[model samples]
Target: MHLVIGGAYQGKLEYAKEKFNIKDEDVFTCTESGDLPQGSKCLYRLELFTLSCVRRGIDPCGAFSDIGAWSGCVIICEDIFCGVVPLDPLAREWREATGRLLNKLSPEACSVTRIFCGIPQKLK
Candidate 1:
C-alpha cells in the first residue's frame, strides 16, 4: 500500500489522484462505520474509520491484517494527532490509535508521502 498523510486541507487526496491516475469510481471515502471497500484503489478518510472502530470497541488493525489486499492501494489519513491534545478520553484514544495504525502501515507501505501546503514530501 502507498500511504498519504497530512493535515486537513493539505491536498492529500488531490495529490493521490494526480499521482495514481485515480478515478472517482476507484476511490472509497470511509465513514464512521469501519466499512472498507476491499476492492477500492484509494481509501480516503481512514482516520474516521479508526474512530468508528474505536467507538465500536474493535481493533482496526485486525481489519487490515491482509496486506495483500492493500498492496496496490493508496491510503490517505489525516494527521489528527498534531497540535493541542483533546481533553476527551475518546478523542485522545482515537488520536493515539490513528497514530499507531499509521506507524504500523508506514514501513509496510510501498511509499509514504506527507502533504503540506499542497506540496508532497516523500518519507518512505
Candidate 2:
C-alpha cells in the first residue's frame, strides 16, 4: 500500500493518479457515511473516513486490520491536524483518529508522499 498526504487543494489526488496509474473507476471518495470500500484501488478523502468512524463510534484502525486486503492500494488523506486544535470535541477526536491512522499506515506503506503546491515530496 502507498500513502499520500497533504492539505486541502494540494493536488494529492492528481499526483496519486499519475504515480499509481489509478483510474477514476478505481477511486473511492470517502465521506461521512457508509463503510470503506475494500474493492477500491484508490481511496480519496480518507480524513472523511476518520470523521465517519468517529461519528459512528467505529475504530478506524481496526477496520484496516487486514493489511493484505489493501496491497497495492493508494490512500490519500488530508492533513487537518496541522493547524490549531479544533474547539469542537468531535472534530478534535477526528483529527486525533486521523493522526493515529496515518501513523499506522505510513510505516506499513511501501511509499509515503506529501504533496505541496502540486509538487510531490517522497517521505518514506
Best candidate according to lDDT: 2
Alpha-carbon shift of residue 116 in model 2 (angstroms): 0.5
Q: Per-model C-alpha lDDT, please?
A: 0.91, 0.92
Lowest lDDT sum, 10 consecutive residues, model 2, at 31-40
Q: Which runs of model 1 end up more than 4 angstroms from their true locations?
A: none
Candidates in order, TM-scores: namely: 0.96, 0.97
- C-alpha lDDT of residue 43 in model 2: 94
**Full-model lDDT, candidate 2:** 0.92
The per-prediction tally of clashing pairs is 0, 0
Tens-digit lDDT string for candidate 1 (1-91): 8999999999999999999999988899999985787767999999999999999988788778987888989999999976798989999
lDDT of 2 by residue, 1-124 (tens): 9999999999999999998899898999998887888867999999988999999999899878998898779999999977998999999999999999999899899999999999999999
